[model samples]
Structures are given as structure tokens and as C-alpha cells.
Target: MTLTVRALRAGVPEDAEAFARTRRATIPYLVCTAEALAWEAAHAPAGQRLHRLLATGPDGTVAGCADTGLLAGSTAPGHGFLHTAVPPGQAGRGAGAALVAAGEAYLAGLGVRRVHSWVADEDGARRFAERLGYRRSRQARFLGLDLRHAPLPELPATLPAGVTLASVADFADDLRPLYEADVECAADEPGDVDVGATPYEVWLRLNWGRPDWDAGLSGVVLVDGRVAAYSVAQTDGVDRYWSGMTGTRRAFRGRGLATLAKLAALRRARAAGYVHAYTGNDATNAPMLAVNRRLGYRVVASEWRHLKAL
Candidate 1:
């Protein structure tokens, strides 16, 4: 079938839905919705320069989608991200190649010095990136948990003194505390770009404000009345639950607060009828990987970071 490429323009509601559907098919481990995708594109910071594209087969179905932009969270400059995905059985066509070419050209025009992409370590995706002058770097894992059957850790019947479990809803009156903890946690995360500089406003818009974000299910750990750790929960409006982000402050690292936060969130999600849970982790993040393993998460898929000098 022949293919055509075009920008995923705003106000075009169908494109968002198509992209979301294709994303679900292309990467089942992650949770995404049309509303969340549209909101992010509309609310992203100006510097983000978020550009989205869609590839349509001759039959008028969405064969693939791509997005590229400058990394908004990094304090440094000239670093951007690229990702192009096509549905299963649609590879070998020109859709993926065309999308990457267009995405790279757009970012390069913006003077992006470097571009990064995550290529799934399967189905010749890594080879595809290599063909495009992208070199493999660090690897990451896509983890999944069978929440309906997996034996989750039992929560302690009694809480430690001055400690409490809370949710994003608990801090509806003030989100800065959560933002502050997130900033600190992101600083230590291993990645090509530093995310410690994510602005409060951008966090509010791109993260906390997403339509799929479950404020009531997302758990936070409190120590002496201060936010110490958090687990952001997102759902697909069905039974699937995904951990958007989970992190613990440096001072609270050894205390298992991050684990505590995730446990609380997962328990709440399972009780609420969610059957599956998914999360991603940098392969080098031993602490989080150990936590996931103890909690029965397995690496269902892996992807490697690929970089190119524009």
C-alpha cells in the first residue's frame, strides 16, 4: 500500500485518536490516551517545540506516528528526543523511514545539536536506527506485573510514628511539595539529559494535569509531614494501571519509602479492579530494578537509547 505523511495538527481530533490507538498496538506496555496526548501537545512549553507526525496508508488508516522535540526538562541546551513507531506487521514499509526523515529534518532545522531515540530491542528496530546513523547507548526495560494474581507485599498494620501515606488528591490544595520532591528525584535518574530543571509550570501542565493521571490513586509517602517519596499512577480508563513515575528523596532512599509509595498505589489500583501494571526503568537503575523484581515485575521488553549528531 502507498503511504503519505502529514503533521498531526491541533483541532484535528481524529489524528490524536489514531495515534493513541497505534501507540497502544506498537507499545502495549505503556498507557496512553488521546486526551492526554492532545493535552500535552497543546500545553507543552514553548521551548519544548513538540512536533508530531502521522503516516497514513493508502486505505486511510494510521500506519505510524512520530514525535520529536527539544528536551524541556534539561537545564542544558541543544538536546532533543525522537521516537517513531509503526504498528505490528507494518514494518518494511516506508512509513517508519519517512517519519524519521521528517522528524529529524524538523528538529535539525531548530538547530538541535543532538537527537536521542529509544529503539525497542526487537523486530530489527535497533538495526533500523543504526541504518539512520543512530548509535546505541544505554538500555532500559519495560516491566509488567500481573496485579490480579501476583502476591503483593502486605502493608504494615501499624504505621511508623509521624509517617503517613497520601495521594496526589491529598495535596490538591498545594502541588509544589510534590513538584519539589519530583525535581530532586529526577536529578539522580540516569539519562542522556538532566531533568532536574523541569519547571513547576511545565510539570503541572505536562504531568500532573494530564487527563489520565489518577490523583486519587497516585500515592505519596510523607515523613514528619513532608513529602518524601511518590508514585504517580495513570490508567487507561479500563483495567490497566501504569506507573508514570516513582521516586524517593536522597534522605529517604534507604527507608523503602519509594517502595512504600508504589505498594500503596498498586494496592489501591488492584482493589479498584485494575488487572495489569506496567512501568519503565533504566537498566542501570539497580535500586529501582531490585524494587520491581521484589514486587514481581518482569522485563517484558527492552529498548536502547540511540543518539545522532544533527
Candidate 2:
């Protein structure tokens, strides 16, 4: 069987669908759709140097996909990412190696000297990464809750004085405050590569414009009429829901506002007929992990960040 790896035809509907399908099949925990994939290819920031690669077999069917791009918001130079995936039954057909080679070549051409990738914490995946000169860096856990069966915490009958909960829709006219809050929270989040201040226009196109982002279901906590904490919600337009981000402002920490916002978001999600919820957190983030556990989330899978220096 002849195999080929090349840049994905972004404008082709079938290629976008195949890319999304491969991602979903390999990493079911993350949210991926044809529209999201196409949007990413079309709207990536200029500095990202994004490259979407696909591996196809003789039959013209996509066997694997890789998303390679420079981390535009990272403070360090030459930092980039390459996420490659091949469906379970399609492994060992040279698809993975082809995708990785293509991804690395593209990033190298863009002058990227360090590349990072997330590998499932499984024996095969770990061995494969190690064989390719990638070393383990950090660990992240994927958590899930059966929204239909798990007992979620009930929202307090009355919020703390000066604290009011509202949907993200409440900030439709202006999202500057929310953007500021997100930047603060993201700067402090634990990760191998620091995501520095994300610009407003970039945030608007990448986060806010996502097809799954549900403004109505997303919860925001206002303290004294100021945005203090928030939980961004995304739905598959079906039963699956995911938490894009849940953070509290620096001054508002330790007050349980993040928990309150997440609880409120989940309640709205459940009421909207979502039956499952998923989220991920760095293994070193103990505080967030505790919050998720308290909310009845269980570890579904773990992934390790692997880095290779070019």
C-alpha cells in the first residue's frame, strides 16, 4: 500500500472532516469538529506558522493527521508544537512516522528549534515518543463526569454578598474585562510552555469564535459589578460538554468563586440536555484538581508532554 504525507488541502471539505475525524478517534477526550478544524486553518495567527499535515494511503483515505505550528504567544523563541494522531487500527503503517517527519520538517523550515507534543500515557505511545528522541516533560490528566449520573454540587441559594453569577452572554457588548481576567489566570496556569498575555483580537478569533463555545451556558461571577471569576463552557451541540477554562481573579482566589462558577455552568449544561462533561488539568495543579474532584470528576486518562530540541 503506497502511503503519502503532505499538507492538508484546507479548502477541501473532505480533508477537514478527515482531519477532525482522526483527531476525535485518537483523542476522544478533546473536542474537535470539521468546522473547528477548518476555522483553525483559516484563522491561525500570522506568527503561529500553522501547518496542517495529513497522511493518506493508496486508497486516498486519510490515515493520520498532524497539526504543527509555532507557539505565537510563548515568550521563548523557537518554541513550537506538533500534535500527531493515527487511529487505533491504523497504527504501525508508517502513518505516525510520516506525519512526525512532515511536521518536524515544516517547523524546522520556520526556524523552530524546540518542538513539544502530547502523548497518551500508554506503553506504546511512550515508547514511540522515546524512540523518536522526545523526552517526557510534564503530565496532564483528563477528567470526566457523567453529567447524567454524577451528583453535582448544588448552587448556593444565595451567592456571597457582592457576588452575582451571570452567563457570558451578559458581556456580549464588550469582552475586554473577560479577556483581562483570562490573561491573568492563564499567565499563572501551570504548564511547560508559558502562554504569555494573549491579545484581545487573537482571543476573540480563537476562543470566542469557536463553534462549540456556548455563551449562554458559560458562567461568570461578578463581584461588586466586576468580572471576578468565570467558567467557559463548550458543547458538541449534542450530549457532550467540555470546560474550556475555569479561573478566578488573583484578588478573588480562595473564596470559592471558581467552584461556584463551574457549578453554575454545569447546572446550566445539564439543564440544556448535556449528559457528559470533560476537562483537563496539569498534574502539578493541585488546587484545580481538588476542585474538580470535589465536583465529582474522575481521572479518565493521562497524557505526558514530550519535547524534542531541533
Candidate 3:
């Protein structure tokens, strides 16, 4: 069987569907869609050289997919990502290897010095990544809440003075506050790379405008009319809810606002008929991890973010 690697054709429904299928087969907990894929390509920042690579089988069917790009948020130059996934049962047939090779070559061409990839904490995936010279760097866990079965805890009542639970929709006219909150909170996250230089317009296009973002269910905690904390929700508009990001403003620490916002969002999501809620946390994020654990989220899977010096 002839295996060919080529650039993904944008605006092709079949290609998008195939890409989503492969992603789900490889990482079912991660929510993806044609809209999200297309939006990413269009809205990615200038430094991020995003490319979607596809591998075709002998009969011309899409067998694997990879997304390679520079991490725009990284403070250091030359940090890149090469995420690859093949249809279940198609791995090791040269599809995964070819996609990895193609992705590495593309990033190297752009003078990227290091590449990071997320690999499922399983034997097969770890072996594949190791074969490509990727080594485990940091670990993360994917948590899911069975929204249809597990009742989300009610919004906490012990909010700090002048604080009230609200939704992102309440800020329909202006969302720069939310962006500012995200940038500030994310800057403190534990990771190999630091997220830097967040611009309002970039946040608008990449985060606020995502098709999956549900402003109505995305809960925000307000203190004296200012955004104090927030938990953004992204849904498939069917039965799944994903916590996009949850953070509290720097000055608003020590108030259980982050947990309150997440609980508010999850309660709304459950009421909206979402059967499942999913999120990921870096292993060292004890505060957020504690909050999620309190909300009944259990680890469903683990992934190691691997890196290789190119």
C-alpha cells in the first residue's frame, strides 16, 4: 500500500470529518470539530506556522493526521509542537511515522529548535513517540464529569463580599476584562513554556469567538462589577461540555471564586442536557486540581507532554 503525506485541503468537509475522526479515535476525551479545526487555521497568530498534515492510504482514504506549528504563547523562540494521530488500528503501518517525520521536517525548515508532542500514557503511544526521539517531559491528567449521572455541586454560598456569580454573556458588549483575566492567570500556570504577550484581538479571535464557546454557560464571578474569576465552557452543542479555562484574577485570591465559577458553569451545563464534562490539568497545578477533585472530577486518562531538541 502506498502511503503519501500531503497538506490538508482547507474548506473540504470530508477532510475535516476525517481529521476529527482520527483525533477522536486517538484522544476521545479531547473535543474537536470541523469548525474548531478551520477556525484554528484562520485565527492562529503570525508566529505560529500552523500546518495540518494528512496521510493517505493506497485507496486515497485519509489514514492519519498531524498538526505542526510553533507555540505562539512560548516566551522563547523556536518552541514548536507536532501532534499526530492515526486512526485506531492504523498505527505502525508507516502512517504515524510518516506524519511525524513530515511534521518534524516542516518545523525544522522554520528553524524550530525544539518540538513537543502529547502522547497518551500508554505503551503503544509512548513507544511510538520514543522511537521518534521524543522523551517524556511533563505529565497531565484528563478528567471527566458524568454530568448526566453525577449531580454537579451547587454554586457556593460563601462568596467574598461584593462578589457575585455571573455569566460571560453578561459582558456581551466588552470582553477585554475576560481576556485580561485569562492572560494574568495563565501566566502563572506550571508548564515547560510560559504563555506571554496576550493581545485583546488575538484572544477575541482564538478564544472568545470559538464555535464551541458558550457564553451563556460560561460562568464568571464578579466583584463590584469587575470580572474577578471565570470558568469558560465549550460544548459540542449535544451532550458534552468542556471547561475551556478557569482562572481567578491576581487580587482576588483566597476567595473560592474559581471553584464557585466552575460549579456554576457545570450546573448550568448539566441543566442544558450535557451528559459529560471534560478538562485537563497539569500535574503540578495543585490549586486547580483540588478544585476539580472537589467537583467530583476523576482522572480518566494521563498524557505525557514529550519534547525533543531538533
Candidate 4:
């Protein structure tokens, strides 16, 4: 069976649908959708040099999917990244290899000096990437909480003095506070690369304006009317929920504000009938890992970021 690898065609709803279907099947812990796929393709920042790659069978079935581009928002340059997914049943047919090859070539052509890929923290997946010259650099765990059955920690009858838990929508009139906090927290996050200061407008378009953004379910902790900690949520408009990010400002750590924000978000999500809640955390982030542990989120799967210099 021959698998054709090429850039995914824009405006083709079927290709987007197939890519979403294949990605969701490959990584069940995260949420993906046809609309999100198309939106990402159309809205990528110019600096990102993003390209969507698709592998299709002779019958037009999507065998695998991958996207390659610069690590947009990264402070340092010459860093590229790719995300590849192949369905379980489609293994061993060279679909994954073909998709990754196309992505690397595209990035190399764009003058990228290095490429980062996230491979599942599994024996076979690691071996595959290692064989292709990618060395594992960092590990992140995907945690899932069964919202239908997990007992979320109780919210205090009254928030700690000078603090208020509010829906992210409450700050619609001004997002600069949230954006500033996000930038600070992102800089401190443990990762392979440092992110440049993303303009407020860029952040607004890429993060706050994403199709999956759910402001009502996202929580922000305000202290003295300042954005202190926040939990961002995304939904499939159905039962699955994703914690896009949960972070606390450096000035407001050790106060349990992160926990407070998460509880608010999870409770709101469960009440909205979302059954599963998912998030990812760096393996070395003990504070956040502890916060998630106390909240009943168990590690469901892990991914190792593998990097290769071109």
C-alpha cells in the first residue's frame, strides 16, 4: 500500500476532518477538531512559517498527519517543531516515517537549524524517534481526571482575603493584565526553548481567540484586583475538556491560588456536563504536579520532546 505525503490542502473540509480524526485517535488525551485544524492553518503567524502535512492512502483515507514550523513566540531563533500522528491500525506502513520526513524537509528548507518533536513516552515510539536522530530532551505528562467520578476539592465558602475567583470572561473589557501574567508565567515554565515576548495582539489572536476557548469555564484568581493566577480551559463543545494552561504569577506563589483557580475551572466544567478533564505538565514541575495530584488528576500518558539538529 502506497501512502502519499503532501501539504494538507486548505479549504478542503474533508482533509481537515480526516486530520482531526487521525490526531484525536492518535492522542486521545488532548482535544482536536476539524474547525480548530482549519483555523490553525489559516491563522498561523508569519514568523511561524507553519505548514500542515498530511499522509493519505490510495483510497484517500488519511493515514497520518504532521505539522512543521518554527517555534513561534520562541525568544531564540532557529528552533523548529513538528507534531506527528498515525492511527494505531496504520502502524508499520511507513506513514509515520513519511509524515515526519516531509515535516523535517519543510522545516530545513525554511532555514531551521534544529527540529523538536514530541514522541509518546513509549518504548516503540522512543525507538522510532531515536532511530531518526532525535534525542529525547524533556518529558511532559498528560493527566486526566474523570470529571464524572472524581471528587474535586471543595471551594472555600469565602476566598482568602483580598482574593476573588472569577470567570475569565469577567476581564473582557481589558485583557492586558491576563496577558502580562501569561507572559511572565510562560517565561518561567520549564521547556526546551524560551519564548519571546508575544505582542498582546498576537496572544489575543492565538490563545484568547482560539476556536476552543471557553471563557466561562476558565478561571482567574484576582488579588487586589490584579490577575494573580489563572486556569485556561478549552472544550470540544461536548464531553471532553482540556486545561490549556494553569499558572500562577511569581509574586503570588505558595498561596494556593493555582489550586483555587483549577478548582473553579473544573467545577464549572463538570457542571457544564464535561466528563473528562485533561492537562499536561512538565515532569520536573513538582509544584504543579503536586497541585494536580491533590486535585485527583492521574498521569494517563507521557511524551518526550525529541530534538535533532539539521
Off by over 4 Å in 1: none
Candidate 2 lDDT, 1-310, residue by residue in tens: 5789988886899998899889989988888888878888888898998889889998888889999999888888999999999999888888988889889988999899999999999999999999999999999999999999998988899878999999999999999999999999998899887777877988988888878799999999999999999999988787888999999999999998899899999999999999989999999999899889989999999999999999
Q: What local distance difference test score does each model get? A: 0.90, 0.91, 0.88, 0.91
Question: lDDT score of model 3?
Answer: 0.88
Clashes in model 4: which pairs? Answer: 75-196
Candidate 3 segments whose C-alpha is farther than 4 A from its true place: 157-160
lDDT of 1: 0.90
Error of 2 at 117 (Å): 0.5
Worst 10 residues of 1 by lDDT: 193-202
RMSD in angstroms, candidate 4?
0.9
Each candidate structure's TM-score, on Cα atoms with residue i matched to residue i, is 0.97, 0.97, 0.96, 0.98
Least well predicted 10-residue stretch by lDDT in candidate 3: 151-160
Which one is best on TM-score? Answer: 4
Question: What is the Cα-based lDDT of residue 154 in candidate 2?
Answer: 84
For candidate 3, give the lDDT of residue 111. 95
* Candidate 2: RMSD to truth: 1.1
- lDDT for predicted candidate 2 compared with the true structure: 0.91
Over the stretch 156-186, how does candidate 4's per-residue lDDT look in tens digits? 9977789988988998888899999998998
